[model samples]
Target chain A: MLSVHRNHPWQAFDKLMRNSMNLGRDLDRMFLNPLTRQRDSFAGWPQFNLWTNDDEIIVTAEVPGLEADQIDVDINNNQLTVSATVEAPELAEGESYQRRERFSGSFERTLRLPFAVDQEKSEARYVDGVLEIRLSKPERDKPRKLSVKAG
Target chain B: MNNSTDLKTTNPPSHELQKQESPTPEGAEPTRETRLYRPHVDILDSADKVTLRVNLPGVNEERTDLTLEKNILTIRGHIDPPHYEGFELVYGEYGVGDFERSFQLTNEIDREGIQASVRNGILTVELPKVKQASKQKITVAAG
Candidate 1:
């Protein structure tokens, strides 16, 4: 399912104002950002889905032809990040590509969760080129069923 | 390898392009067939064979169809949509849909020797060159 970004109408203007104030500093940061880590702009490669429930949050990404060791997933301060690279296979001598559309590059996506999660308890599995990560909500975050006494 | 052999990448028609090409027929259901997506494909033609690699995540052997008839080769594959119980989507980048691509085979291809396989959601199709065409050698006479 694809959705339009639900950003507040004023958010863009707000960002513009802030960016103008720190233009020089931001330029330096931008130059350094790509050297260290490249971040996705909401919609990026190997598109993923984020799901939330009462007990857990699930994130799934479609990354075909990638080995498990190539992917790195981490969560810190309620933000989950997934990073991976899709490398194009080396071609043999005298072999040239006729059609090249598949992407081959590194990508990183990060999202903040509404509730705290137990990172240690989370489980991840890659099946048929899809990576699914299940992040369980902390014990304190789980909803409690309340019992009512006869009134 | 002959550098003169023409190699072209054909792009599938987008909605706007399709609309420009021809008018939609009357009583045609737009919603039913609006989801036609073109899978990214790469084709490599060597002296002896042509190799095609298509990115088809979540597609397996059971859900894919490959056929060649009358010099038209077609690839059709379906990917099962992922569903989460009681889950509201927070962010999504790609939509889950079926993919279809077709190619017009040339006379140089050995239609009988086509082979296909799927691994890690990557489909590789091999089309061998016709022996007679690749083996033809022009002899130069000394005057």
Candidate 2:
């Protein structure tokens, strides 16, 4: 399995292995803003959604402001990876950004499916800045119904 | 052997940008219909024009509408949610919704020359400035 976290000199400092910190955080949140849950769930660039069924698994990702050719998708067994190079918005001559809150840059993410996928039968489409990849489960891994015997 | 380092600065600023969730409007009732979001944006200023680069994914030119009323410029983008029939959503970090936001324009803007276009998933709106918007030197007459 590939890892998103890279090796750093101060990895221990970055990833704090706290034991009893959840109680303090929960207490702080209960007093501060407990009613409204913050939307800041994943601290990543783009967001993705995953759907699964008996036969197929669907993966949809938000790749805003990118062309179809600019995005690359690869699947190795059950692991799927998506990578893209997102460029900054084009400016004609003297225009400079006064305020910017959009995501852009080289992005790569890999997700694992429950079962190995049939790579040959997989299909992907980029529509309205959203990339959707559909992967079908191999015949052996697919669930088969066992008929009930009536004696 | 790197020893001395600034402890305050954990992650040094890089060129990579991160996505922020749309901010909920203050003092407004949350809509019960389709989810609404204020898309992230970038405001660019030039000598003669101010441009706005809006991040509106899942929206195309046909579904986007821009209008100027008085001094406020409104951008409304309609998006259709992905169909989840016969499928179970195992994981979701964000929800799909429409994008709607308004920006107040200054009087110096040349409203006539304002133009907008959409490419990929970004919307670019150019608001040109009027002649009087530039700096002018006033002459003083000694009486």
Candidate 3:
């Protein structure tokens, strides 16, 4: 006998719930955050990526044409914020832009982690225009293995 | 085909920033092929020269390759993906990969005079326009 494909009802319910939540967010953005041409262009500058290990969480952002001193990184507990403003390039007296696509403006983005981090022990590095922040998980937040006694 | 080679971009409509596909493997182990991305660029035109400014974060001078094959100019930058020991990626807004972009040069461009430089992850290339031969000013006094 051919195995019948099982269709779980929960999966459909989960999808429906997610779709409604997303629709709510879309409505909220349309009403609360008015979409402007300027906002659409640079609102999402410097995309980010996050990684986690047993003891630390790593956050990285691509900030091209910026140095370590140009960008700011701040962390409080489980919240991390990265902000920067790109200076506009100067043009010569007779020169003008034929095609401009790069972004130049100030933007700040904040992220909340699953657990709090140790701010004092955290480290940040800027290399090749990429910013990386390693936030160490606090002692109480890290997982601890409890060995079972032999019976 | 998920050949463990090709990559795709995460952001759907971000045309200004670098666009590359993950092609990032599930783990830290290296994949058989490297992912390629196209960096954003600004073109500046002047009376004598045109300048191209390319955004190439995480790229250095040594890892960049600029070539002009006939009229096609190619810019390639190789970068090592950000990796942390024993860490798993939790969130990703962008992918890391090599940057590759190409532009076509016209006959008016002086290919021999073209020059490029990379600094602070930005690459600038200047292409000079070939000078036109001087026009003769004919005198009609004696004619």
Candidate 4:
């Protein structure tokens, strides 16, 4: 006759060890992952949104504390590049920084357009720290209306 | 009787002296008020020019201040904080910190043509490039 239930001490110990190791791994990933990752030069790139309208493609980027002249916009070979250098904040004389969170440096972002753009017709405007770029799509890529005969 | 006399000779309440030195506004009832602080910031290039943006939440465009002194740019503004009397805040989360940020300009910025504007909660500063620093076309002479 076999016992209805059996208690295994080794099984309980093994489960406890597995749970402890899993917790340790989770903590290591949470704390060390970001510190060990390699960051790009343009790590603090501003958030931007790109969308297309009927005849133009619009790109909006959040570039706080930057002037219009500080930014350079170049379009070449169907790609648009936006580059700018932001100077770091100056510390006061004999003042030691306690906590610094703001980021400052040169950054560049290149975006490829879905359709070829008319480089000459592109326009950029900066308002309220937001940069808006409007690029007119090439004439051939624009949608054309076709006439249909009613049968 | 001697103990009571010694207690009276002790230092007067400090609150009384403060009240006398700075009297409250005449006919203005004291009300608890809160104010939000938002810092102004500027972005500039290697040249010492000012490019500023002020984050002024719940503040009108007319109430903000933007100033530039030599190579330093300062932005100052105020926002009305929330008001809730007799309400205990449980699990409160949102509050705005006062804003005060300054930037030192470099020599390349054109200080004369700095432009600024504020709309919504964002302030934008435009620092024009100096004429000599801009890329210019060099003409070739025929040999």
Best by TM-score: 2
Q: Which run of 10 residues does model 4 chain B get worst, by summed lDDT?
A: B13-22
The per-model DockQ list reads 0.27, 0.30, 0.28, 0.02
- What is the DockQ of the complex in model 4? 0.02
Residue B23 error, candidate 4, Å: 39
**Each prediction's TM-score against the native?**
0.69, 0.72, 0.71, 0.40
By lDDT rank, best first, the candidates go 2, 3, 1, 4
Off by over 4 Å in 2: A1-43, A145-151, B1-32, B132-142
Candidate ranking under TM-score, highest first, comes to: 2, 3, 1, 4
Instruction: Put down candidate 1 lDDT per residue, A1-151, tens digits, no spaces.
Output: 1122254666767778988857644432333232333322222465668888777888887787787788899988488888887665555555556655665556677778767789888988887677898999878778888899999
Better of 3 and 4 by lDDT: 3
Give the runs in model 1 whose Cα sits over 4 Å from its true position. A1-43, A145-151, B1-34, B132-143
Off by over 4 Å in 4: A1-40, A146-151, B1-143
Report how far off residue A56 is in candidate 2 (Å): 0.8
Candidate 3 lDDT by residue in tens digits, A84-117: 8765465665666555567655678889886789
Estimate the TM-score for candidate 1: 0.69
**Residue-level error in angstroms, candidate 4, position B64:** 6.5
Tens digits of lDDT, candidate 1, B22-72: 233468643443244577776776778889988777788887899888999
lDDT of 4 by residue, A1-151 (tens): 1232245546766878999977754543332232333222452254345666556677766565566778899987478889876443443333222222233455687877666788888999875445778788778777888899899
Q: Model 2, A77-117: lDDT tens per residue?
A: 99998888766555456655566566545668888787789
